[model samples]
Target chain A: MKIALFGNPNTGKSSMFNLLTGLRQQVSNFPGVTIEKRIGTFKIGDQKHQLTDFPGTYSIYPHSLDEEIVSQVVTNPTHEDFPELAIVVVDSSNLERNMLLFTQLYDLKIPLVLVLNMWDIAEKNGIKIDISALEFLFPGTPIITMNARIGLGKERLFAAISTTNKAQELSPFYDGFFPSPIEDKDAQKQEIQDRYEKLRTILPSIQGKKSSVKSTFSRKLDAIIIHRFWGYFIFSAVLLIIFQFIFAFATLPMDWIEHLFITLSAWLSGALPDGVLNNLLTQGILPGIAGVLMFIPQIALLFFFIALLEESGYLSRVVFIMDRLMRPFGLNGKSIVPLMSSVACAIPGIMATRTISDWKERLITIIIAPLMSCSARIPVYTLLIALVIPKTYVFGFISLQGLVLFALYSLGLVAALLLALVLKKFIRSKNNGFLIMEMPEYKKPRWSNIMISITEKIKVFVWDAGKVILAISIILWVLAAYGPSDSMSSKIRAIKETSLYIKSTEPQKETMIASAKLEGSFIGITGKYIEPIISPLGYDWKIGISLISSFAAREVFVGSLSTIHAVHDENERHENLQTHLKEARRSDGTPVYSLATGASLMVFYVFAMQCMATLAVVKKETKSWRWPFIQLVIMGIMAYVGALITYLILT
Target chain B: MIQEIAVVLLLILSLAYLCYRLNRKFFSSGKGCDTCAFSEKGKIEHLN
Candidate 1:
């Protein structure tokens, strides 16, 4: 059986679909998270059913691309995804508003199982629905009340589905609600108003008296949260605390992971036989993986906070407040959701633009989306901040490093808005964008859902980034370990022949040979070739090499550095990448990761479109190489200029 | 000499694997990236 789940936005329709099919399609408190139709399967007894979770829409008439999918599938009998049975999941708490789509679907004469999801929320709000009365009004349709989040009514729902093979023969509610031609706009509007008028009369009888407790509390909270001045202040303060907490809480775990990896590498280096495979294992792969994994604590914490905001319904309020600020930049309040999602990743952030109806606004949002610093840049920022920024406190509590990290994130948002303002001028649109969304009642965060989200995000990060890091590490180790012809060995021999080499201790001699061999190797030659181009940004050839490798993903910059430094100081058992970088010196005896260099690199990462994955998503979303190509060039120039200015100012 | 040959072979295999994955990510599967959140769904429902 092909079952289609449809509902108004945020009615827990996707939640019911997930409960039925046992697939975790990303569900949040807000609407439009499921912007595409998702298909999953569930089996009851010997019969299997394919369930499609269509994007939420208020009516048959569509406003956005997401809503169009619902209209396209539900209205057309010959459509491939049209369903044999439609499950109309409505918010039991808001039946009058929710039943508009249900009645419209009824006028289509399709079989529907009216699923009253969030029944618990309705009951808490003191909404008593006389189920017998509702069933009488919409005779023969199975009305099942379910709390989908907690799986309260699964068996009854299954029983209802089992009995409902087809919609029973019954008179239409409106008797040809679409009597006028489909293209007649005025007729459609009148029909909708007529439907609402009819619903108001019938709903009062079915719905018992409702307590105003929850709504009163919610409205009072919103007054302060979405206030013109207090809202922005509170939002900024919330961000300040989140960044501070990430930096403060994650340091201990990050340090332990770094130490553990360094100890393991040293042990393996001594235990394994001295050979190429041993070098690759201890110096190449282990450190590369370590560099990526050490920042898991921070990444997990970042996702946890985002999940908390989303679950608590505060994210929608943030979007509301940001809408006012975004209007001047040729963006609507809707653009903020994608920009906020970009903090996690730009790919989904760009994909989230489907919810915006205006073409010009959506395009501008897509172009500026990459300017938001994503989680991939977290490791890069953390490393650079730890390298140069002091460990001092600002107000005896705020870590100076944390403040700098927060500033970097803020800088990305500022740059995105500025770019959108510029793009808004060139792009012309006939439609003006507006946001009309429901503010879901704030609820306590679900710990299990937060944990699941954190696990999924971390898995994507480690598994996806680990592959690239390990591969590049191996290739880099090869390039740094050996050189063309007899270049490395000859360089080592030449270094050994120097009087300074003979006069040095054993460790010092090994260090000299290591330096000589690295400079003579393949990666070294390539890095040196590009050194002049990047010199104005206070980067060495080694940093230049990392810059090149990090084009695969922004997070790869850390692994690239670890691999390079691991190869450079093979004889030295450094405690961590930070320690190795700290001790590194230039040929002129100045420190390599100086304040100017570290700040410049962080600025560069903040503006650079380093992730090819992001560019690929842009290409797919925009359906053209032109936009992604333009993004690459514009961001590349911005990164260079930004880095150059930072270097010059700091130096 | 055995270790040297082993290292060379391993490098070749890793490079090949990288190329294969990249091909799958970009050209073959048309999924954005294996790392992408929507990578499991090879294609999003098109607006067109």
Candidate 2:
């Protein structure tokens, strides 16, 4: 059997799916969390069934692309995903609004088992739903009250599912409404009003309430949290504290991990015979993996705070307040969701634009979405900030490095807004976008869910990104290790003829030879080819090489630098990447990572479209090669010009 | 000599794997976002 779960947004529909299917699809305390259909399998008795959790929608009438997906699957019986039965999950505490979706689905004539999820919440709010009365009103429908959060009513749900084997010959809520498709907008509005009127008549008979009133905690908090000025202030303060904690709390673990990798690399280099394999492991693979793993503490910390804000329903308030700011930039409040999601990665963020109804707003959001700094940029940002920015505190407590990290994130946001203004002038749409979203009742953050989300995020970051980093590291190692015979021998001969090389000791000569070999290597030659173009932006050939390689993925920049530096400074085998970069110098003996160069490079990364994954997603979403090509050209120009201006100002 | 040849083979294999992944991520059409790092974690099954 194929069963489909449907409900209004934030109605615990996905929570019920997770309970039954034993899959951890992301269930947050906000709407539009499930932008894609999540499919999983579960067994009932001897029979196994596939269950799909669709994006939440309000009615059979589609408003946005996500809702259109639901309408298409349900209205067309011949569709492959058309379910044998449907589970209409509704919030029992707010039964009136939720029942609109149920009535619409009921008239579709599909077999459904009405699930009043969040039953405990209803009871706690002094509201009681008479199940037998609801059953009598919609005869042959098995009504089950459930608290899906804790699996309180799973057994009854299973029993109800088992009994609903066939569609009942129940009376339609509106007899003649369906046969003639209500094509006119006025007719659709009239039909919806009629349904609500009927629901009002039936609600008194089925619902009973106690003397105690519903809680107003969420309303009380919203007064301050969503206040025009204080809301922005509190949000900024919260972000500042989060960055502070990430740096302060993660330092010990990050240092330990860095130390461990360095010690391991050193031991391996000595323990093994000095050969090609030894060099491959110590110089290539270990450094790359180490560069990625050392930042695990920071990544985990960042996701930890994000999960809390999301699960506690605070993120919805951020979206609510940010809507006012977003409207002037050719975007509406709904654009905030995709923009916020892009902070984790832009691929899903672009996919989330399906929730936006206006074509122009959606297109504008997709174009500017990647400018939001993502987790992939975290390693790049943190590494450069540490290398250039002072670690001294500003207010006697705030770490300067953390403040710079926050500023880089804000820079991305500001750049995104500015570009959206420019794109808005070009793109045109007649329909105005409206954000009709629910303010889900705030609740305590669930620790178990937060831990699971963080673990899964870490796993994805390591495994998916690790594979690419390791592969590129190997190729880079091979390129840096050798060169053409003519080029290599000529460099070696030229270096040996110098008085400095002639007068140097044996160890010094070996170090000099290694440096000469790296400069003449294949990768070096390639980097030098682009050096002139990037030199005005304060980048050397080495930085140019990292810039080229990191196009595979933004995080690969750190790995590339680690591998390249490892090969260049063979004598400093025990030093970590940060120390190696700190001591690097130009041919003029000036510091390679001076403030001007570091700031310029960081600004470049802020504007660059470096992630191939993001490009692929934009291509898939827009269904045109033209948009992605334009995006690439626009961002490339932005990166070069932005970096050049920053270098000039700083120098 | 054997170790050097083995290292060289491994390098070639790595390059081949990268090429294959890049092609599949960009050119191939599929149900999911093929290049997305978070896709494996998200477990999205596009109904289309």
Candidate 3:
């Protein structure tokens, strides 16, 4: 038997689903829509049952895309996922409001098992529920008390499920509440109001409160956290702390990973015989893998804080506070979550726009979301910031490097809002967006959930981004290692015999030879071809190569550069790539990565639509090539203009 | 000479494997967002 799990948002439905399925859940889309369908299986005695967790909705009358999905599947008997049984998860502390949906489902004639979740919270709030009385009021439906967060009331829920019979007709309780085959809009509204009135009359019989007060602590916390004046201040402080934490916590692990990879590369290069296999291991594969792995600490830390903020329910308060502020930019409050999620990665951020009911707001949100500097941009930013920004203390406390990082992030955000304002004028959206979010009560962050989220995000980064980086590295290494047969060998030999090379130290001679060979290689030719186009933005032929290769992924910029520089310097094979970049000089005897060039590169990365993965996701989400193409062109122009301006100003 | 041939063949195989993985990730259907492991399957339909 297939069981459909439905609930209003934030009713512990996900917790119950997690409890039932553990790690056995599979997430897919509903047949033709982007709404996620999560399916899991569990055994009841000798029989296995499938549980489908539908997107949460307030009432069966759909207002949003997610809600429409629930209404469509539940009402259509011919639907592929029509359920044999439905479990309506509800918050016990807020039974009155939650029962509104239950009554609607009851009228729809769907058999349901009421899972009153957060029963512990209800009891602590001095609210008492008469489960048997409530069951009596809605005949044939079973009510199970549950505190899913702590894994309580599972056996009882299962027992209730076992004994419950699937009802094929509407319950007697819904007889007078709904009009049969209601067609008139005005009449439908009257009918809903009448049902609520009836529910209000019956509420006292099934629910009793020792005191009228509930959620005093949440209320007290919200007073300050959501205060108009102090809320922004608190949020700013929170963001500052999070950035500081990311830098402080991730530096050691990043250093260790970098050291480990360098040592491994050095060892492999020495141990293996001089051949393509050895070169592939040390030059092509290891550095690429290291580049992806090195950023895991920062990525993991960012997701860790985000997951904590979300799990603690503070994020919703941020949405609540920022809604009015976002409205003038043509985005609604609901766009905040997706935009924030974009900071971790834009793909998920774009996917998260599903919750917005207004099509125009959601579309604008998707279009501008990539402007938020995602974790993929972190590697590029860190490389440039470390190269150019002085690590001095500001105001005797703030690190200048951190401030530059903060400025880059802020630049992305300010650009996103400003662009949204412009897009708002052009995109013809008639729908007026409104926010109807529930602020979930604050609670201690669930360590298990946090760990799972961090692990999953890190795994995705390594495997998804890792594969592309690895491929690019291998292909690039081959191109950089072998050039046109005659010119490459001749150039190397000529450089080795030069009077300048003969007078230099052993390390300098090795460097000279490696540099000469690279210049004659195929990859070098390609870079030189594109150097004219990128030189205006303060990039040389080598940086040109990285800029082109990294379009596959922004983080790949660091990996590609590391691979190119590593392959060229045998003496500095184990030296840090940053050091090599710092010492590199242009044709005019200035450092390749001077402050002007570094700042220009950072600016370019900030505005560029560089990630093919993001474009692919945008293509899927919008289901058209038109939007992604426009995005690419517009962002490309912005990047060029922005970088050129920065370079000129700094130089 | 045999050892050199063997090493070249290994490099070719590795490159081939990488191409296959890249193709699967980028071109395959029902896998939304190649960058996110937890991304849902199926392309989003245009909102009417």
Candidate 4:
């Protein structure tokens, strides 16, 4: 039997869901992991059920993404999977504000059970809820007072689910959904407001105290974090540390993966018999693909920290602080969360854009979202940082490499805001509301929750993004592996027959040459197709292929380069891929990955909307492919122009 | 098979225990949730 658990923000609806389902829950991306949904399952009396924990919102009258999603789930009849039972959970402590939603759900009159979660919080604050009185107020339903945060008061919830009879049908509160043409919409809204005031008059009779209690610590922290001057300074400093760590500390692990892949590729070439098929699979495919996969550690680690910050109740603070600065750019403080989270990946970040209600602001937020230096850009950035940004120590304290990495991240953020401001000229923003957020009380983060969140993110990354990337990498390898020609085989033979100077120390020179010859022969031709286009962007034919392949994912470029270099049978002797890249030259013997070219590539990846998954999500969230298409064209032009300027200025 | 059955049996046991706890709080109490005094302490500190 299908049952839907729906509720408002801070209503303990999620807490109840956790109690009911326990661990039998999986979060799936609405498309893939990045634009995912949380679905949990539980059974009551041998009747197993699925519960989709939709994003919490205040009303069915939509404002943000969360509200729209819940509104669709509550009102829509055309959806194939409609709920047989709808359980509306509310906060009992503030019945007046809480009743605003309860009345609407009551109007719907589906088989309903009312759960007052955090009932414990209500009683402590000296609030008395007359359960029978509330039941009398809203007829034909079971009312249960429960504390879902702990195990207390949950069984009656399950029983209410299992055994509740159909609720008595209540007449529509409004003649229709708001803004009716027949009557003045404003007057109808006032009438609804008057009814809410009438209910408020009797609420005190059910409560022990005149008012419910709110946490003061959250209020104090919100003040400091959201303070105008101090807030921006703290935000900039925190961002600086995060970028510095990614550049300095993440490099060791990155280098290890690089060496591991190089060794594996060289070993595979040596062991496999010298054949066209072996050459295609081992060197051409494996190394090119490994570059994309190797970034999981850095990207996963970045998300792990973000998840921790969110769980610790600090991410909301960052948004609160940035709201003032970002507001002028057609975004409110709430838009900052999506922009910051987009740094991990754009799907969640774009979905997070639902927090913005104004359509103009929401569109602007979605458009600029891809510009935040997401972790996908890190691979592209890291490669450039290693090549162009010199390894010099600044004041014997900071690494120059780290400084450049930090600058790149800062540039991306600056560019995002600038673009958003430019877009403001075209968009008409309807922002009126002040920043209202439930600053979740600062509790020492539950380790278990952080772990679960990280695990969920990684699972989405590996299973969803991973699957698409892996398949695409193999296809790219094939394209680079075999063209519709026999020139590739002869090229391999020719390279082997000519080169006299051999390194005796490394045992597998012949296999490497044959593999390298195959790569240059077929994929070389393919990469050359777009070489002229990207050549001005400071990339050669090999880079051109990687760049084109990277349209599937930006991280794949690193892998494509890895494959190209490792094909020459070079192994762990080079500390990193940068050494091989440094030695690489053009047809006339000039260095290919010059300082200008490398910088241009980094700028391109920063602004380019490359992830197909992110595009799919934008299409899904915006409810049209129109937005994603516009995002692609606009960002593509910005990236090309930005890269062109950088290359031109330097060269 | 024994291990599988045991795992299933344990899962059932967990559900039954959760049901017992939920039922006691919801059916019998018929009062405010914070009346328990356990979660009330957090609320007291939170108010400050």
DockQ of 4: 0.01
Residue pairs in collision within model 1: none
Per-prediction tally of clashes: 0, 0, 0, 12
What are the per-residue Cα lDDT tens digits for candidate 3 across B20-40?
A: 755653565555554344334
True contacts kept of each: 0.30, 0.47, 0.19, 0.00
Writing each residue's lDDT as its tens digit, candidate 4 over A190-268 gives: 7558657766787777666665665677668767766788777777766666666767677787777767876776687
Global Cα RMSD, each model: 2.5, 2.2, 3.7, 11.8
Q: Write the per-residue lDDT of candidate 3 for residues A85-184, one digit (tens) a residue.
A: 8999988877777888888777777778999998887787778889888977887788899988778999998888788756756446656654334236
Best by TM-score: 2
Evaluated at residue A70, the lDDT of candidate 1 is 83
Candidate 1's C-alpha runs over 4 A off are A177-187, A209-214, A486-503, A572-574, B28-30, B33-48
TM-score per prediction, in order, is 0.94, 0.96, 0.91, 0.78
Query: Runs in model 3 with CA error above 4 Å?
Result: A24-34, A168-170, A176-188, A209-214, A487-503, B1-28, B33-48
Candidate 2 off by > 4 Å: A179-184, A209-214, A503-507, B34-43
Instruction: Quote the positional error of residue A616 for candidate 2 in Å.
Output: 0.2
lDDT tens digits, residue span A1-651, model 2: 889999998888888888988877767776777787888788889988788899998877777888888888888889998988899999887778788888877888889999998888788777888889898888878999999988999999899888896877789887665722426667777778888889888887788852224369988988999999999999988988888888788879988998999999999998988899999889888898888888888889999999999888899898888888778876866788889889988877888888888878898889899999998888898889889998899979988888888888899999999999898889977776777666766888889988988887788788878988999999999999988978878888989999999999987888788878888899878888999999999999989988998998999999999999998766755788899899888979899999999999999999999988888778877888888889988889999999999999999
Which whole-number lDDT from 0 to 100 does residue A39 have in model 3?
A: 72
Q: What's the iRMSD of model 3?
A: 5.4
Q: What is the docking quality class of candidate 2?
A: acceptable
